[model samples]
Target: MFEQALGIFLMLAILSVLIVVHECGHFLVARLFGFQTPVFGVGLPFGPYISLGRKWNTEFRIYAFLLGGFVAIPELGDETNASNSSEAFGVELNPFKKFPIWQRALVAVAGVTFNAIFAYFLMVVMFFSVGRQVEQTYVSALDPSNPIAKQAGVLAGDDIVALDKHPVTSTHEVIAYLGNRKSTPVTLSLIRDGKPLDLVMTTSPKGKVGMVLGQKPAQYIKIDAGPVETLGLAGSELVDRTRLMVVGLAEMVQALTPDFGPAQPGAPPKPGFKNLHGVLAVVKIGAGMVQIDWRSMFMFTIMISMDLAIINLLPWPALDGGHLAFMLVEAIRGKPIEERAHGEMVKWGFLSLIALMVLVMVNDVSALMNGELDIKPEMKEKLKGR
Candidate 1:
């Protein structure tokens, strides 16, 4: 029990740091652009409670009741009182209100950008701390009954060059490209017998491109340059992995959309959507990762970071995307939305967000109790050995 509690606490701490860094991106950009951002918080609000006066003027005061480590930019474009008529009328620059629509939009997007950058940095650290591991390619032993390799006559040693014309340099890339493919035949370009060749490989209903490339451990240590080159390599690796994740997610979402051909009638029902997991889910996942191998832990961290970026960019209220949407509207209308209306929109957004969070929480709990969250026995044994 104590171990579980410690795991939960560790998870919360990691998540909190990630969230704070993301929000800080927004706060920093807002301040840089001359907006008066008064409060920076670390967690959801627990109501107006007196904060001990700290040396760094970290004393707490609550002006609004919604909890979440959030930043509050001063009300924009509201000058009802005579005392600040000039400021309201734009005689002086209203940092929040006076910015052009595009600038305001960037301030909102800064949070997601921060998440991406942080993920990249963390990825670099992981690479240096532990070198890359690649799985061996094994296409030779494919079942003769498999339609994909049979039609193409793809041999095991054929090095994959491209998938449907897209470059295939990495396993993650292979996963993303294959995820987008239908069961139909895909043209695979490969190098065989030291000659560039193309094959019309039919994919199986499972969507495999029908050829596997061999994998090996290829680690390069920059003993001379030490930290700098390692960091750069990690950054590049992060960008590569993040791109793959984003592409995979986009394909998944596309499949779920109603416009995508309805899942064949009577086909097994798709897994239910679990879109808005909140802090509790975050804690549980983090704890679970810590119990896994370093590779899994790092991969999960990157996945979570990507998830944060994608979700925050959706045009929903109380999200960066929401602010972006409003900024776009303001741009088109030639004026910012009324402060009251904006506030109401934010309130509604918060309510909807909370409702989604609750649903995800219930799903997480069910998934845990049902043993859905456990790693497979084989995988668990493998990781344990690692």
Candidate 2:
């Protein structure tokens, strides 16, 4: 019970910190460019709030709901509803705009830029503390009816030594090799029961052997990395993780179609409401990470930070990317979008986000009631191997 409470606190704290960091990026860049920043809020600018004094012609505020934060730079020209959105939210804009389009673009992108940087820094710290996780081709489960592997004598807990006589240490390597040669004969060199064994099998047309791969902490050997090497590794980690996330998001959208099919062998079941995590889901799973050690928290925080950055980069209404899209359209046509249309779109977008949040919460509640939200139970079994 205590672990669960601590996990909830940590998740909320991390979300608040990420939001503030993202907002700070915009606040700093706008101030640097001498923009008329009327308000810099620590929390979402809504409802009852307390003023935290004024500095540099800017009023700082803390709102009642502290889930996210925002900054208001009047010169950036989100002044569609000056009387309502601007004044009601303490974000009143001056009549005249001063900054050029390019400068506005920089200010708009700074939030995501800061998020990316923050993720990288976390990666560096994690690497320095516990080193990078090395992937191993360790077999955790096999299909009960896997005739070829069973006939050729493959067993659970075997270390996959190679695929087709090519030495391999990672499951990804074996997958890539098979994917390139579909429906082919394969030779697996494995180490089982402290003895080397060979297993030959014909893969499915999709190049699957019907085995589940899992790596525990005990199977990972960490290597000390130099500073320069760590920088390269950190940058590579960011790029790779971002690419995987983008692919996963695209797949999720595709799976929403009416004719969506089951995932390929060994792939996770297609994500939907049940697997789509939100605040409740994160807190539940985060409790498990908290109980494990600091390493889990580091990975979770880094990934969540990057996720926030990526989500903001999407060209959806009321997002930073949407503002950039508007600027782009203006750049092409030499005039900004119509004020009414912009205001309407932003209003609807904000509503849509709230709706999405509510839907996710409902799904989370259902999953919790079904006894599927807690991760601590599974962690007990998995951690024993580690």
Candidate 3:
């Protein structure tokens, strides 16, 4: 029970920090543009609010429910509105609406931008401290019953150089390359005993080419990287991680279709509703990582930061991306959208967001009841060996 509580605490702490940083981006940028952002808060508004003092005319707040946060910038317009009048927060240099469209757009984008920047910084620190571990693209194991591997004539110890002409330096690269190609024949370039060979194999319906790549070393030899080198490496890693996440999301969407099939024997499970995790799962995973190592926990935090950035940038209503979309329309049309229309759209967007949260939570509970949260047998064995 204590372990569970610790995990929940850690998750909330990490999430609160991320939310605060995101809100701070909006608060600072809004203040810079002379817009009145009266409230900068951590946690959702549904919780009990505690004032955390004030700075720069902004009321900082901490809420009881520590899931997410917001920066409340009153609607920018003429001073006639009660909220904009002297009775409320004092009138600022300019109303939020009076600001140039470009400035407004920047304020909307600031939160996502800050999240991405934070993730990048975390990546740099991770690389510097733990050093990067580049896994070799060598076939380590193959299930004899895997028809695809047997037909492809792949052998243990064969070094995979490329897939369909795309150079692959690691097992993850190979998986990402093949995972996107369902029912497509792929050319695998391999080197075995100093002999180069080409083999062809079609992926299963589940998009898996039944084989496991060699595990990375238990201990990596850290290389000291200069500032320039570290930046380059971090940037490249960020791009790769972003690409993988996009692909994973796409796969999840595909899984929602009725035709989603089962995984092949000994193959990793296919993406499906079962893969949709919620806050509970996140807390559990975060706590588990904390117990394992600080490095792992830091890496998880970085991944969550990037995920937050991407999710906010998605062009959905009530999201930062949705606000940016409106700004884009306003820019092209040379006028702002009607206030009523904007408000209605945002209301629907909020409803949609809430619905999604409920759905994910339901899925999380179902998974827990079904005992599906445990690691797979194969993965468990691998972890034990490590």
Q: How does candidate 3 fare on TM-score?
A: 0.80
Superposed Cα RMSD, model 2: 4.2
TM-score of each: 0.73, 0.82, 0.80
lDDT for model 3, on a 0 to 1 scale? 0.73
Instruction: Report how far residue 64 has shifted in candidate 3, in Å.
Output: 1.1
Candidate 1 residue lDDT tens string, 12-77: 666766777787887778767776554455556444443433322222333233224665454322
Q: List lDDT for all candidates, in order.
A: 0.63, 0.75, 0.73
Between which residue pairs do clashes occur in model 1?
Answer: 44-68, 45-67, 45-68, 136-215, 137-213, 137-214, 137-215
lDDT of 3 at 196: 88
For TM-score, the strongest prediction is 2
Tens-digit per-residue lDDT, 128-199, candidate 3:
877654444788888665669766798888888889887676566788778779899999999889998999
Better of 1 and 2 by lDDT: 2
